[model samples]
Target: MTRSVYVTGIGRGDGRQVVELGMMELLTRQVDRVGLYRPLVHDTPDRIFELLRGRYRLTQDPATYFGMGYEEAAALQAEQGQDALTARLVEGYLRVAESYDTVLVLGSDFAATNLPAELGVNARLANECGASVLPVIGGRDQNAESVVAEVRNAHHAYTNLGCDVIAMVANRVDPDQLDSAADQLRRSLDVPVYVLPDEPALSAPTVRQIVQTLGAEVLLGDDAGLARDALDFVFGGAMLPTFLPALTPGCVVVTPGDRADLIIGALAAHSAGAPPIAGVLLTLGEKPGQDILRLADRLAPGTPVVAVPTGSFLTATELFGLDGKLGAGTPRKAETALGLFETGVDTTELTERLSVARSARVTPMMFEHALLERARTNKRRIVLPEGGEERILRAAEVLLRRGVCELTLLGEEDAVRKKAGDLGIGLDDPALDIVDPHTSPLRDRFAALYAKLRAHKGVSYELAYDVVADVSYFGTLMVQEGLADGMVSGAVHSTAATIRPAFEIIKTRPGAAIVSSVFFMCLADRVLVYGDCAVNPDPDAEQLADIAIQAAGTAARFDVQPRVAMLSYSTGTSGSGADVDKVRAATELVRQRRPDLLVEGPIQYDAAVSPVVAAAKLPGSAVAGRATVLVFPDLNTGNNTYKAVQRSAGAVAVGPVLQGLRKPVNDLSRGALVQDIVNTVAITAIQAQGDLR
Candidate 1:
């Protein structure tokens, strides 16, 4: 029988769509063909379903995804009483369950329905469909004790109705209260409980959502502006200087359209990137003059501006009622929601609870999901030296929003804020720490520490003071002094600049001869660990063996079972040379040191990974052609090979994650994208967890 999972909420504003979307993300990673079923939907189009279909490429018919419209279902329930409604929804769910390997059944919202008790209705549907229930309890304005009590009550409510409650989630609590809230919930409930802090971005109304809610006329803006989230609302009634300071990043400015001075001043501030507003709301049916509108257009080309007939007070009232939703136009919000859910929930345990088995194949999405889930465990703090860089700040936002780990961005505070403002990114979260390395109080302390560490090298405190002022050195000192667990740099600096401080101050780990790097090459169907690609020009026989051992440990740390393959020119004495001899010696050393490790060597790349080639070249050799971990002899070959495969084969290379370090410090390519930084940061956090134990 096909498995079904039901995601339902107890009340309104529970934000359960995050759970539903997150569950779908996990399901798709486990099963090849997953279907979606909505027991009851509003009369409007199912926005969340549309988003899932577009994102996951579901082949199920759009019409088949839903059972009945809200009015139709409520009428049936009122006429034929509850039995008719239950039968209709169960029929829709069974169809999807029969057609796909698994089905994600979205339950009804308690509010905006005619049913007497939506909770009871949802329980009956879950029980009738033979689905596992994930009950969501809202904790937006509740205390920790109250949230825990509500969750326990939810479990009783579901279980009393004979529904199999797989887990309970306490969502939308204050960020600072999450830890205490989660602790209480875990202690109170017997089943698995996950706690997600409130995300203001999800609750904030986007420009598009606001437009639809208010029926406002769009005077100016593009699609990108429409998607910008309005985090806060600022009323424009005071003088230009006073109002300008109130205009914040991602806020909608509400003012009279005739006040071109306030309008022009806001736009100018946005142009200067002081703090970019979401859009300007023209109240009282007022519209800007053609000349002023054109100036606003040139000031910020794509910034949104809408006009409504209602006054400021009424407009604010309606705006406050509107909340953002996860859908097709809001892909970024969807990503944020998914990250929050994955970070807070223990997905491995959740799968076990549901008895869902994941596929052996490791797709890129699955690998990315694992990276996020693993980083969340230890919650290490990572410092970024190039904090003011656009890509770094964006990555920092993603990291913090996902609750993956703590972050300290090192730079000039004012400059970083202005840059982030211009990009329309919000940095108001309390967990985010921004430090100016030059002006930080820790500068003198770090300088003293650096001088002492380098005293034998004739370094004085004064000279070390200047050295510690550099962002890279300051960040590295944080890792050395235990202020941060790791550091990720090289976004704006050379690789040498990024790692020079680590080698000088942090140094290598004990029982390790050298530091090397590996890239987790994410192919179409599998993830292969490629090592020593970015560091160490060449290694002797002993050093080569050490790299293999370190690389194997790193692979296993990330849940990738290790099968070590030492690469060289020859395959089992088929050829002989200086390179082949070194590889052969290294292979022997590995066999002696780690006898349990499956080892092969002086093997060609083809024979190491291709079963057909292994059958012909080195028959019956255990480690040939099925290796999960591939250790190259030198940097030149490994670097070129990983790059070739990454580009030619369309693989995602997630690394040069440094191995054999005392503390975790990773580097990024100067040309890295936003996602590249996110992946590397997550990897660094996971590496730090290993350091802790």
Candidate 2:
């Protein structure tokens, strides 16, 4: 039977969607082909279903997952009986389950339907589908004791109905009460319980949501502007001075459309970014005249300005009632929700409890998710040298949003701030620090340290001062001085410039012969390691063996079991040449040094990766065709092969991750995308986790 999990809530406004989305994230991290099923939905399109399909790239037809609409479900229950309704729902669910390795079943929303005793109905569906129940309890307006009591009652209710209650989640608890509620539940409950505090971002209405709810016209703004979350509602009824003082960051200003002065002032404020408003909402169906609108456009281009037919009072009422939904349209909300869920829940233990077998094949998405989760376990501070670059700033926003690491961006504070403002990235976050390498007080100290380290080269204090002012050298010095755990740079610089400072300051590890690199080639089914792809040009036999050892160690650290394959043009003794001889020598050295490692050499690419080729040429060899780590004899072969496979096979090549450094310092391709920068930062953080220094 296919394993299934039912995420249900005891009452409305529990914010159970967070739990449901988090569960899907967890399932996808372990297995591919995970399915989603909604036992009952309202008449409209399911927002959460669309989100899952888009986010996870699910190809399954949406119709297959919906058991039935709530109206039909209610009619079936009322007319035929409860048993008849459940049987039909189970039949629909089973169809979805059979096609997937595991299925996540979303239970009915209690507020949507007029069906009575919704909890009992959900329990019956879970029991009939043979699914484990993960119940959610709302702690929005309740005290710590009430939250605890509610969880206890919910656990018993599900168990009494013969539903296998795997765990319980209490969401939207007050931050102050989170600890108390969690401790009480831990002592009282037999099973595990997770608590998530209320997040304002998840609840704040977006400009798009307001426009949709009010039936307003978008006279101005783009998709980016409409996506801004409205954290506050500022009514612009007073004069410019009073209204300007009341304006807050992420606020939506509501005023009569004829009030052109207030509109221009608000747009000017948003342009200056003193406190960026989410948008401006004009009431009474009035729009600013062409001249005023043209001026407003100059002040803040693409800033959202909408018009609604309703008056100011009615608009305020509607705005206050509207809340954001965690759906396909709101990606920022999804990130915030995932961050909250991952931080509060013990997902490792929860997954173990589910007893879902881990798939042997690791997809690209699965590998990326594992990197993030592992990095978060021991958060490290990483310095980015190219802080002024656009891609770096965007990647920093994503990293901070996901709670990935502490970042110190090296650039002039004023310039970086202006650029971030232009990109609409908030720079006031506590986890991020912007530094000017030239004017910082630490520059003198760093220069002194550098002079001492390079004293034998006859480098004077003045020369050292100039050298430390370079961003790459400054960031590398931070890592060497233990001020930062790792560093990721080279988005705008060459690989040589990024690591040359490391070569001078950090040096190699104790037992390492030379610093090498590897590219984690994320293919469709699994991830393979390709070494010396971005570092060495033409390493000797001894250096080749060392690279193999380092690559294997790197693979093992990331949970990819190491099976070393030394690639050459020849398969075993089929050919004779200097290249084959070099590979054969390296293979012998690896076996002699680390006898425990499974290694094969002088193997062609096809024989190394293809089972049929291995069966014909090198039968029964441990690492013949099952190689997870491929060590190239030279950089020319490694680099070209990785690029070919990446382009031809549609693989995601992450790295040129520098191995054997004393402290972690990785380089990004100058043409790296935003996601590539994010991945490199995460990899650097994870590498820092193992450093005892």
Candidate 3:
């Protein structure tokens, strides 16, 4: 099954960039598909879809994705009664829900008021679609009660409408207040509550905003005079043609005199019932030739054109770069979606506190004392793949500046230096090693491993070099060959691209049979472990047992007890099938293999999750409910279910911390946002420290 999560409520000014960035974060955790659905979008089209479609290459259509099929519900509200409009909205939402695994229903701007009725509509739709409703409340203030009330109201509406309440997310909360607000909501609400921190990293510059930031004025006709913001700016003469379709209203065309024809033609096409051209800023102090001017006049008469005194288009690009206005503040809707993912909400802690429950297993140490001691005393080698990139450089700089660990970047010295120079970043430190894959002594070792793995399949040494040159494989080989303490990749690659090479070269830990993943969910009050979402699909009992053990180990590493809950569709003897049987057998195997483990299985998610539900399901079962580590039977069930809980239940999901590698190594998705990369790096660092133990 294709892994998917549905997202909605995207058409507002609260910066959907974070949503896009956040969704990219989810993608790294191995979710194959992400669907956006806005059941009742306003009459005005949301520009995010256009931006995402063009810039991010998102294939889903914005019109249909948002569920605004020609007639918008807001438009219907004026003609029909509110109830009728609500029904239409609900119908649209239901249609979207059927196509995706987890549906993220966005509340309108008037969620404080309109949500009461809208929530009912969504609840009915959720029930019909068997989807979870994650209410994402976008706000600027830290009024805990108001936020809690909004969440509760949505939950109440959904519950009253005969749907389950999953979670509530407080979007755009100030960083300082994020913890407090999350805490307040967690205490007040029965379900999980997450506060998405306001991260400026995800915001991309709008063309209008970019123009304004550069101190350029717009002069194109009426629409040009109208204030518009550019979603992003494109550079290079070669890219101008490709970027034209991505141009929205208020897009300022910045180009050189040599490309006047290109600029004029693009502007003409854009102004023809197009969104609107913010204006054109001619670079290189060159005016259009007579022929170009005549064409511009005929195509877009009176279009405002500004000329910069810069010597060349490249210089103008550099100017924008120097000002930090080059695609830096543009909002990415995907990041906003990711920020909506409920993390840092301690659902287990809350559940235990609310129900006065105790875990069957003893709590672990606050910190891994032995590991911390080892990290403090030893010089640990950390490998970062695609080290030539700006983000990785910045991360490495951070680690170096803080004296955290020794950093190694995988790249050729000259190319890395050149790229670093282009970005105006200099790394002069001797501690940082720029290892060229071709020249490194360890290259032979990696080549040998590559040959050993592929030789049986008719791959030769020469072929192995080309394949292993991919940093994912190269970096994994570094760990396998004991050249690095840990390896971190995936920023420039997919999960498969990152992990497959590792699986082939490094293989799993000696005793571990299958590789799996677990996210250490950090909430305001506590942390819960969610597993098998990042790796493994349709895991049998043995694989499930392995996941359970790994999740428990991860929980322990993070200072939490391992009260493992093997999640299934049924609770105890209530349901029977291969899926339930897998969970039950896994539970039995976990007990047999590791009697020290406290585990329960063949349990419904709620029963495995809630103490109240657990008590009701099995009166005296030892591990009936207070389980901290949730081990899913398969990727399909784990990924979709976790996202449902993350988005709808308001649980902040943190990881798919890749486990079972010989050394701690993890991957990042190619489109992962900065914060996600930062967090993954931090997690990888911590995991590296864990290996010292």
Model 2 per-residue lDDT tens digits across residues 131-157: 999999999988999999999999999
| Candidate 2 segments exceeding 4 Å error | 43-45, 258-261, 289-302, 388-390, 414-429, 455-459, 691-693
- Residue 391 shift from truth in candidate 1, angstroms: 2.2
State which candidate, 1 or 3, has the greater lDDT.
Answer: 1
In angstroms, the error of model 1 at 655 is: 0.7
RMSD versus native structure for model 1:
4.5
Candidate 3 lDDT, 1-693, residue by residue in tens? 222222323223444344444443333222223345555555445644454444333456555556553345545656776667656666665555456433344434432323335544555545554454445565555465565566566556656777554555567677777777777776887777667766432333333444455565433333323222333344536664676666654345677766865677666654453434545667766777778766775665555555665655554565455321212223332323332342333333322322322322321111121222234344567788778876777666544533446778989877675444333233566667888877777777777778988887888888887777777788888777777877777777678887888788777877788888987665433467889887787888888898888778877876677888888888888899887888899999999988998888877778876779888997787777677788888888888877787667565455568888777887765665554555565566677765411
Give the C-alpha miss distance for residue 356 in model 2, angstroms: 1.9
lDDT measured at residue 613 in model 3 versus the true structure, 0 to 100: 86
Comparing 1 and 2 on TM-score, the stronger one: 2
- Put down candidate 1 lDDT per residue, 1-693, tens digits, no spaces: 788899998888899989999899889877767889998888546898889998776768988899998889889998998998899889988888888878899999887788888899999999998899999988998888788888888999999999999999989988888899888777777899999999888888789889999999999888767878999999999999888888877899999888899888998888776787888889999998899999998988778889999999899899988888889888768878987888789888898898876677887767887887778777999999998998998898888877888999999887787667655677877768999999999999999999999999999999999999999999999999999999999999999999989999999998788888899999978899999999899999999999999999998898888999999887998989899999999999999999989999989999999999999999999988799899999999999999999999999999999988899999999999998999999999999987521
